[model samples]
Each structure stands twice: as structure tokens, then as C-alpha cells.
Target: MKFEVTILGSNSALPTTKRFPTAQVLNVLERFFLIDCGEGTQIQMKRFRLPMSRINHVLISHMHGDHIFGLIGLLSTFALQGRKSDLHIYGHSKLEKLIRFQLELLETKLDYEIFYHTIFGTNIQTLFEDDSLIVQSFPLKHGAMPCAGFLFKEKERLRTLKSDMLSFYNIPIKNRHGIKQGDDFICDDGEVIPNDKLTKDAPKVRSYAFCTDTAYLPKIVPIIAGVDLLYHEATFLKTEEKRAKKTYHSTAEQAGKIAAEAKVKKLLIGHFSARFDDLKEHLEEAKNIFPNTALAEDGKIFSVELDRD
Candidate 1:
């Protein structure tokens, strides 16, 4: 029932003394998902004490070294550790080639099979979905390499049963699930009990969005609107707006603008340029527009509570 993201590395292309490259782990009810494995991602994951073997799905934003350099190391480690579960990776087609090429060069065979899913196009696409969670990949406007942003949405939970009501009606345990799922309960005597009288409202659906290595593309706002938490890359400050535009990156101010326009409950700005010795200015610029902004610091955890605002 837990939903949260752990920031592993928050720096941009370069690894600074204070921060590593871009990486994160999203845990949705113990399903670990690795998002954008950048340099030193393995070390960061170990430092954070996340169970590396539990991460079955990996999402790569783009083939940029800063975004995917650590994938080979992670895969190699999995082999070394004798992993058995089949792994899945989602990204541009080239991502699979890169990993396969490296593995072939090493002449090392892994015990687990890897399934590479091609997620292309400049539109939103479903990557993974289950009864409890759905993960979608949306295009990120970052050059022609075909980067992607991700959206994680938790499905609406069933209603909580009213204990007193259940006992009052002597509802059978076998019928409780249907009652929680909004089905009316029929007594043994053929009396119908409205579902609302036996159960409270279902928990609200929650969501999180991850946008990185992209420009200020407002089109994505619709896809990520009203997300409980949004982690958008802020690679520079407004002072370097032109550079950010040229590199297809976003400034902290621009990140804030997107958050404000999207109406997300909270915003986390990261992917900081190595040139920045301190991130106070970056936080300040983003907060100027979206007051609920926080820096995506390394090892920081951002949780999406079930309650809706």
C-alpha cells in the first residue's frame, strides 16, 4: 500500500562532488522500478539500501550517457548475483542494442532473460499496467534521440467495510469482497443491503510524473495534470535560459511554470547543472512560481499519499 520515489542521483550530465548523475527508484507497493539509470546508480542504490534484485522493470529516458550509463553495470551485477527473474526494460530501440552489445563484448551470459520494449512516438503510450498500478510513457521533447517521461498512477482502491455493519448483518466472509467492490449484499432471507450502508468510500487514486532531459513542452501538462507529485528536470536557472533552450533543457523557472500550469500538488526540481555549487537559487526560482516546489536531492524520498487534495 506504499507509494514513493527515492531519488538516487540528481546531478545533470556531470557528476559533482555533492551529487551524482540522474537516477531514481519508484516503489509502488513493493514493486521496485528503476527510472533513468545514470552514472554511479549502483553505488547510490546500494547506499540507499534498496533491494537491487527486486527491480524487475527499468525505464530509460534516453540514450544519453548521463541518463543510461549505469545500466550495463547494473545488468552485470544482476548476472553476478545469480538473478533468475526475467527483467523488462522500456526505452528507445537503441537501448536494447547498447546493452546487448556490451554484454556480447564481455562474453558473459546472464541467468535471467531481458525483455526490451520499444517505446517510441511523440505521444503517450502505456508501458505497464496491472490491477493496482499503471505506468505510462510519454514523449519528452529532448532532441531527436527520443527521450520519454513517465507517469505512474495507482488505481482506485475498493471501499473499506464498516465493521459494525458487517457484524450487524452477519455478512459472510465470502461476500465481503463483493460488498467492498460496490455490490449490494443480499441476505439469506433475500433482503438486499445497499453497498453504501456497509462500506465507506474507496481511497482516491494517486499519481506521480517524472519529466527529465526535456524542454519546456507545455503539451505534457495535460497528461500530468493534477499529479500528486511531479519530478521535473531543472538543469539551469533563468539566467541561463538561452543555454537551456539550446540544449533542450529546462530552467528552474520554466519547471515551476510547468508545475503551476499543470496544477500538480507538488513539484520536485532536479537534474542540476554541475556548475551550480548551491541549489538555493534553483529552488528559489522554481518556488517563485510554484510555492510547493522542492529540490530533488539525492536520497530524498517523495511519497504520494492516498488522500486527494
Candidate 2:
């Protein structure tokens, strides 16, 4: 039930001494999702002690070099390590083509299969889902590039059964599953026992949204609204708003505004410009609008703890 996101790299297009490009790993119930593999991402993963073997889903936001340069290396390493599990990559058609071209050019024979899921159009749609979790993709305002934002959502779980109550009512084994699914119990006397009396509330559903390398986009508010944690790109400060617009990147203030509008619980700002030697100002700028904002540092892990049942 562990849920957390580890920042592998946090720099923008440039690779600074303190920061690499953009890369992250989201671990939900040990199902790892690698997001935006920038240059040196493999090294970062190693440095952070992440188990690369656990990563099966790779989500690329776009075909930008700073966002995807390290992907080839990671894929190669997976082959070198003799990974057998099939890897599922989600991104634009161009990304699949680029990866295919590189793999062909290198003549590298992989030890596993790679399944590509193309992200197209501007509509928000489910990219992956299961009984306990779901991941969706939404379009970002990165000009000319088919970039996307991702939302990771934990599904509502079954109610927690109270052992003492179940025993007291002599609930049948066959009826326990239904009770967990929010059904009332009927005794031999035909008395209906309330579900609330027999079970505790289920854990609160958690959600995380990742939005990077995009311009100030308010249209994503509805899609990412009220998420438990939100990681948004702040590639510039408000002093360079015009520059941010020109580069189709967001400023710290803009990121904060988006978080506030979306009403997310916490905002994580990253994708910093190389010019910034210190990120204090960027954090401050974001805190101006969204007080619960924090900077996304390389190798840092932000965890969302499970709710009490």
C-alpha cells in the first residue's frame, strides 16, 4: 500500500551540476512508473538506490531531448541486465518511432518485449488501470510538441471488516466478502445488521498528478482537481514570464496558480532553469499562491501516507 514519487532529475533543458534534466519514479504498491527519463536518469536511479528492475511502465511526456535523452541508456541497461518482463511504454507516436530507430540503429537485441501506447489528441483518457489503481493522460500546452500530463489515482477500496462484530453476529464465511463490499448482513432471525456496524470505513483514495514542460494551462484544472499531491513544472520565475511563454514552460507563480485553482492538497514544483543557482526564490514565488508548495529536488522522495481506516 506504499505510494511515493522519487525525483530522479529536476533541471530543465540544461544539465546543471546540481540537477540533471527531468525524470521521476512513482511507486504505488510496488508498481513502479518511470516518468520522463532525461539524461543521466540511470545514474540517478542507481544513486537513489532505486530498484530499476521493478520499473515496467515508462511514460514519456514528449520527444524533447532533455526529457527523453536517458531513455535509450536505461533501455540498454535493462537488456544488459537480462530483464525478461515485458516493458510497457506510453507516449506519442514520435517517441515510439525514435526509440525504435535508436534500437535498430544500435542493433541492440533486447531480452524483452516493449509495448508502446501512443498518447494522442487533447482529450483526457485512461492509459492504464487495474482493480486498485489507475493512470490517465491529459494534454499539456507544450507548443508543437505532443506533450502530456499524467494522473495516478488509487481506487476506492473495500470496507475494513470488524472481526469482533462479525463474530458477534456469527456472519457466514460466504457473506464476509459482501460485507466488505458495503453490504448489510442478515441473521438467521431475519434481522438486518447495518454495514457500518460491522465494518470500518475504507482508506481514503489517493491521487497524484504530474504536469511538466507545459505552459500555463488552466484547462487541466478539472482533470487534476483535488489531487493529494501535484508535481508541476516551474521552469522559470515570474521575472521571466515572457520567456516562459516563449519557451512554452511555466513559471513558479504560474505553477502555484494552477495548484490553487485545482485545489490540490500539496504542490511540488520542479523543472528549474539552469540560471537558478538557488531555488529559494522559486519556492517562495510558488508559496505566494499555494502555501503548501515544495521544491522537487533530485533523489528526493515525496510520500503520500495511507489514510486511517
Output the number of the lDDT-best candidate.
2
Residue 258's lDDT within candidate 1 is 96
lDDT of each: 0.93, 0.94
Best by TM-score: 2
Q: On residues 1-309, what C-alpha lDDT tens digit does candidate 2 reach at each position?
A: 889999999999999978999999999999999999999999999999999999999999888999999999999999999999999999989888999999999999998999999998478879999999999999998999878999999999999999999999988899999999999988888999999999998889999999988999999999999999999999999999999999899999999999999999999999999989999999999999999999999989999998963
**Residue 208 lDDT, candidate 2, scale 0-100:** 97
Off by over 4 Å in 1: 188-192
What's model 1's lDDT at 246?
91
For candidate 1, write residues 1-309 as lDDT tens digits.
778999999999999967989999999999999999998899999999999999999999888999999999999999999999999999999998999999999997999999999998568899999999999999888876688999999988899899999999999999999888899999889999999899988778989999998999999999999998999999999999999999999999999999999999999999999998899999999999999999999999988776632
